[model samples]
Target: CELSSNASVSPGNFILHPSCDYDGLIPSVVFFLSFLLGVPGNIAVIIFRPNFQHLSSVSQKLMLNLVVSDLLCLLTLPLWIYAFLYMWTFGLVACKLLTFFVYCSTYGSGLTVTVLSVQRYLLVVHQKNWTHQMGVRLLLVLLWLFSIILSIPQLVFRQVTTLQNKTLCQSQYSSQAQRITVLLVEGLVGFTIFFLVVFSYTRLQKKVKQAAFFNNPQTTRLVTCIITSVFIFWVPYHFFDVLSAAAIFLNNEDLLQFCLTALYTVKALHAVNSCLNPLLYAFTSHNLCCKKSLSPKI
Candidate 1:
């Protein structure tokens, strides 16, 4: 949502929400907890391994990239909390730069995860020759670069706005048309990446059934964890997004209000995915791997 309006001449007229106190507190709490978990969890992943230097698998590297991005995203969350709790004290430049970093990190996390799945599918099912590809180091660099480029819009478009004498930090897209454009781009890009992931897995599943690794329950659980959360979290948000787009396109006043409210809740639920992934997918796999590594030799 557009946080505040930056039109200097008419500073106090752009308040998007009615109650800043309530709005500020709720998200501040949520994002604070997220930052707490994300920062330490990711750092420990790197630090806890004894042979961290030697450990280099395609999947592991991708996961590392994911954690790094999540950490970056979490770091910026405090700025949001600060804005809500106090005021837009950082001014416009800090607001846009901080928000841009957050968006970049977000895309990095999503894309890294998606690519990890594809990598797993390839290794497990296709048995393709992955060698001579410059390995995980190159891929990690590419992931960050891709994330930065994709998040360029957020950097270029976001700004601080003042409404009703309160300053808010948010991305600026003036009209419904612009909002739709951003939403559509996000939906299309996300769908395309996810579609590839799904398709690759579908083809891989048939082969997995015939492979020895498929017999491992952990493998099954990992696949299930990623796909289930992605669908469950993203689908509702997108459903509401499509509805919002429809209302805008159709000029349905009543539906727009109803859908926008619903969209707010759905988007909140979608953000929960960030926190849930670490607990459900990452921690579980870490536990499983540790168990196997510690098991007695036959």
Candidate 2:
């Protein structure tokens, strides 16, 4: 969903029922809490990175990168909250920049999680080869570049427009084809990455079962947490995006309205993923205090 327009639309214009206020209010509270929690949690992940001696591993590095992505997304929450409560006063430049960063960080986080799952699968199911670690830094650079490329559509399409004398920032598609194209790209990319992650984790799980590797419960727990967290936060958001795209393609106003209503709730859930990652790290790694010398397993 386009964060600015979908979220900042006046309740009077969109709310069909009296209870619609609850829908908006609850998710607004969720976004607020997510911002309060996510910022410090991701910061802690960076400040207290694992202290492995061998430059750590791909998974460790990916975790740090994941935090960076989440933090970038979270930094825009204050603006989001402001827009949700009032209106988008940030103008066109800030609007485009914020939306661009959100998309970049979102795509980055998804790719990072997918790659982390792949790294874990390899480590768990196959013999670790030095080549797996080769070009780790370069891979990260490419991932961010890819994320930027994925986000280019947002920068190109988003605009600041005045509505009812209220200035707002939102995506302004010139054509139905353009809208569907962007939505399809976003949904497909997210689903593709998540599908890979799920496949890798499924294989890893089967391997763990066959190998009876329950002796190290922490490893299994960590994998479960990562997979579950990513899936829970992202799947619904992408699902709604796909549905919204279909609604637009079909010119189904009812379905479009339903998708928009659901978007706010799912968007908040999606943002909560950032806040949950650090807690997942703490619980899975047994490093709640951040000073522990535990080897990074995820």
Candidate 3:
């Protein structure tokens, strides 16, 4: 909506426009860490999923998909860091492609986790025969399909632009209205899925207080860890986007620019989520020798 940050604005009083200190090192280190953890973690999950007889459950397959998505997203981080440092040296097409892959993997991971939650709900609440209906193959197919569809907009809207002799990869929405539409849709979808997961977990907890299977500490821990990771990593970023969208509508340039830059940090943090997922979700299981055993599948 407002012009890009590179757009000219008359230099006002220096006192009025104090320089904001942005810690560039934090992002560079974080991105490096993410790439380090995400690659091997996702690979291990993928490799062990079929080979490990203990964790060969249907639910584990979805977890593998989540790890794979995280890894894919993480694999692009070096380029992201380079882009941030060198201001998107990769040309227009490469910029678009990289941005597209990033969004596709991130959104795919989000949707996969949401689907896992819904599957858990179905299994625990209705106790239905969903495993046969939506096995790993079917779920994997749908996962890729949904990811591609949701990612189309990124491909359509992203562009590479030169600013002060440095290129930057950015979304190039044709209209503010379309951008708002996309944000609204993403918000609604995220909220809906989040709500369903929390509600289902609440109901599940209430019913299983004394049951041995229900009281399994590992199951509770796993769910708590995953939920916490998602909330901590995503909630701030999503809320920031909401504020950015609202600011755009209000036509507040200064506030919107500040918010966008701040959201850039949050976006980088969100990228870190994929890296953390493997640590929070899979690392403990493997270490405890629990990866091979399905004590309780969440």
Give the candidate number with the greatest lDDT.
2
Say which candidate scores most in TM-score. 2
TM-score ranking from best candidate downward: 2, 3, 1
Worst 10 residues of 1 by lDDT: 6-15
Residue-level lDDT tens digits of model 3 in 214-283? 4356656656776677776667666655666676678877777876556555556656778777666555
User: lDDT, candidate 1, residue 37?
Assistant: 74
Clashing pairs in 2: none
Compose the digit string of candidate 1's lDDT tens values, residues 6-90. Answer: 2211110111242346654555676678767767776776576323333225555666677677777666666666665666778
1 versus 3: better lDDT goes to: 3
- How does each model score on TM-score? 0.77, 0.83, 0.81
User: How far in Å is the alpha carbon of 75 misplaced in model 3?
Assistant: 0.8
Ranking by lDDT: 2, 3, 1
Looking at model 3, the pairs that clash are none
Off by over 4 Å in 3: 1-23, 50-56, 133-136, 213-217, 283-298
* RMSD after Cα superposition, model 1: 6.0
